[model samples]
Target: MSTANTSNNTDSAIGAPVSATLPTLSRQDRDDSRPQQYPSPSSPHATSATSPPIPTPSPRNGRAGYQLSLPIPRLQRSEWVNLEGLVECALSSLGKDECTGISELGRGSHNSLYEIRFSDGTSCAASISNSPRQFFSADAKRSEIATMQYIHSSKLYKIPIPKIYSWDLTFDNKVGAPYILRECVKGKNLSEDGRFYRLNARDKQKVVKELAHVQAELSKPSEFTQLGYIYRQEGENGQFYVGKMATVPSGSDEEDKMRESFMGPYDSLTELWEARIERETLCAIGNWSQLPSDASLPSMLPPAKANPQQFGELQQLLSGLTNLFTPPEQLSKLCIHHSDLAIRNVLFDEKTLKITGVIDWEFASVMPLVITGRFPNDLGWEGNEFARSLGKFGNVSDGGVWNHHYYDWTSLSGVQPPPRADMPSPPASPTHSPASIDYLTTPNATANGYLFEHQASVLEDFDNSEGRAPSPPSPPLPPPPTSETSQQDLTSRATNLVELYYYRKFYASKLAARNFNLTRLFIDAVAYIKFNEIVLGGPEKWFASADWIKEVYWRMQEEDESAREDLMEGKGVVKVPEVFLAVRRREVDLGKWENKVMSMR
Candidate 1:
């Protein structure tokens, strides 16, 4: 690869035009010019606005001039409920309770969490959903409550889950949003000591067994006609009926828009699989501009309309992989699945190696057993390595059944994992430091914590949502591909890994059609390549009609290399990294009907 020259389009951070040769400031000089680091957890600045502003390199608009500042796109500000109002709402749920203490737990794209304590020493957590989406609707919230209540009632697994004390799904109350108050699970997250790496072999083995049992219980066949989200609906006579998601998901509206009509509690696995693909495609196209931006991404050049032929090729690639996962004839068993089963959602008594609570069931649904049998993602995840592993063609293997240690839990007879005698250490002591236990448990991906929740949180939060104003759909969907076409896509010599190639091709065309900013496109492309380098073996794709893509890829790689060099010398600018998890489709009502319910109230 030839060295990249930035003389034509790129300018320095200070707005000075750059020469063909790159700047060569001393490491110390670069370090001095770099942005200030986040303050220590104990420092007042750590948790307050006193800290330095997040660096926004060249946050310029339009497609004309380009500068080489960090490419962190602006965060879209969404409507959030007042913390004081939220506190009052939680207190009201408890009926004449006196609030002794309260603190903001955390906030995600759609929900804000708060922990409340009453004078009677009773504590509970309030999860208030704001700006609900198709994936995180009132129905999804209701499903979560029903699932947790069911689990607690069934006593199926030895593990425990938080008990719901109160819930309001209609937002008919003063809170004006769906809120749930539940028992505050009192244990450290399983990842408190650095994920699985920090756990002893005994602890690891113990956790695996316990989790397997929980899996078995959830997978047990129950009274259900088809596969979909599980929710509780109260009838006119005051009887609550448990069944499929209150609203099945249809791939036709903006993810944030709630609708009454959806696909189904499919009778066949193939039908469900097709619905899943349709939902994803619709979401990507419909919510392109609503996604979030990443701080570390490099901006893209002005995107031009992609050629129909190129777009068609990309479509063929996507269809290929979609079919690979969605078998046509095989009827897979369906069962309840915790779609987002990661370490952060699992609370543990580390000393005793016992699971305290399993939280966050918004994405829970009844789906094919293969979907649930795959090992928990946290099993082998750790930073960039996890990304690299995804790209490794050799790693392309079928999912396996959960490893059973104690009993033949595969039968789903509500059996528990073997009991152990180990006693758990006391919870970490309270501290005023910003990194205290409270802040640590917030599900987020930052330098300080595990990135699983961070990944799960950012699915619809795409990086270029606003940086590039979306254009009209360029090329319409082509005829679906046949089995032979899919086979060709997988066997392509350019990349042995079929999955990575198809995703890259599909997104490239999709973004181009939407007129994604050129610089941002380059940044996203390179990051994808770097993270999945092992899978692709190397970045080589003949199907990419946008020639500028290769150039930007090389340039961004060069810039990243330079930044790393400066980082080693303690003087280079560092971009805040971002993670993307697959979008989980479950039943959620964005509020069309809820609004009607509120109106009646």
Candidate 2:
């Protein structure tokens, strides 16, 4: 092979203009698109704003741009939420006298949620999601925090609301995401309340009116506050839209065929702010794992065992849900609404059929306001579950099986979100943002809506839901391929490992060579390697244990210089310093997520 190692389009960050790609949960189905990092030529101050001398424009648009992705920040904003004196303060602020005192229940996924009991023993639930790092900047994060702060400060009036006890700066640190605390109100998610459908027409009308009222609250701009992403004013009238983003992601083989502009750095926090209203002005766009299989689809469907009428009803629901993804003219509009609106993400009271608290508001971006589907239509099946849980930063919503909402809980606090239309036409140019989204003008057709009731605060009836279904039985998929596909998969996996190692070494070299600070470089270096591990199916899996990583140091060797020369020749392998051998042997968190889940749960 030639000695020349081709850098190809190795320029990191979103090179050239890239298209959007979905990061679907299922590994195979993830977005092949890339993130766009640099500004376009049209912007007045585009040249002066960015740093690192914006790398070369991508040679093309569709390539993974993994070669062109920007360096993952060593400084990823830590999701920090810490609260001091939140429970007492929240109770005092609500100023209600139902019982004697409140004790802390365990937390849900996002905020450290708590249930406050009154003197007479009535209870309410509250959640507070706040953190340091980019909460100082992330528009969506700020949006959630600010919106809750607004409602809490005003005692969340009008609808049955969770009294936001307070949103104060408790403290900050590297480990824990900082947080604010609020009371858990008495309510249940409408989706879970089967009793809701049993309500008389008059009761249903009252519910509809309450729902309308919630939407009305969201319609006005004041109830919503700035999410804090930077939006720059662009175009004829100098309209402001979403500008720079704080959580701008770096490209990864984690991406596929197309380039994704998901990650990058913010030019300024103001840019993050300006990004809110501004249309996609220029700079644009932009986690994990596991699986279990299930039975034949026939059994999975309700019709398999049901009579004709039941089968027809099931078919309609399936068709309606399926139809959500059909292409349309207008894309979902983005505005300030409850980000965590999943069926599982709510609280309620049984008797009155009221909504108590809306929890989990994490991935709350001002994107197309898709109203119909309870879950994100863009995400595949696996992603839908994740979106319900991990997407929001506000409330905690796990699958319905382990839920406590079935009791007499009512979620009175409601929301007003505009319905989603088809994917909007591409931006007039290469810019698009939430404000640019146009769902208001497009007519949306009515689809089936969910009917349910308030939750009663009784002990969980989990036994019914839990043991009802047997463990999923797997079916044989297509037979394994000849050695060919398997080899390709292995080769691809190995190549990824090599490339991961190469990039880490390359990045370290870049940092040291440029005289970047060791602190920043150190953080970036570790993270870069971790990102690579994700591609290599992870290091912990490969190494098996941390002890192995330590034990294997300097022991693994290339059998010959020819192998070394090959890895180096075409792939910049020749330049790799010997120190990387040592780097690979270093031990770090092997099963952070598993450990975290077990301990935290």
* Per-candidate clash tally: 13, 120
Model 2 residue 576 distance off true place after TM-score fit, in angstroms: 52
Q: Provide TM-scores for the models.
A: 0.46, 0.29
Candidate 1 per-residue lDDT, tens place, 1-601, comes to 0000111110000111111111111122111111111111222221111111222222223211122111111211135343334445554455423444443444444554545544344556666764433333456566677776666666444447766777666545545566777666545544422444456655656666555555655655545557666765552123223444443233335432432323465664445434443543453344333535322111121112222333334334433322223311111345567755555566566467677677767646776543443334344232122122222211211110101100111121211221122532211111111111010011121112211222222323421222110110111112222223343432331132222233323333433343322213323223222211111111111122122222222333456555545533434322312321222222365867875896599
Model 1, residue 398: C-alpha shift (Å)? 13
**Segments in model 2 whose C-alpha atoms lie over 4 Å from true places:** 1-106, 116-141, 151-160, 167-177, 190-209, 220-334, 342-601
The models' CA-based lDDT, in order, is 0.37, 0.27
User: In model 2, what lDDT does residue 540 have?
Assistant: 15
Instruction: Give the lowest summed-lDDT range of ten residues in model 1.
Output: 399-408
| Model 1, runs deviating above 4 Å | 1-80, 130-136, 155-158, 170-172, 193-195, 235-262, 276-331, 382-601
- lDDT (Cα, 0-100) at 51 in candidate 1: 12
Task: List model 2 lDDT by residue over 297-387, tens digit each.
Answer: 1122222222233323332332222221211212122344443333234434445645544544333334222221121110011111111
Residue 539 displacement in candidate 2 (angstroms): 24
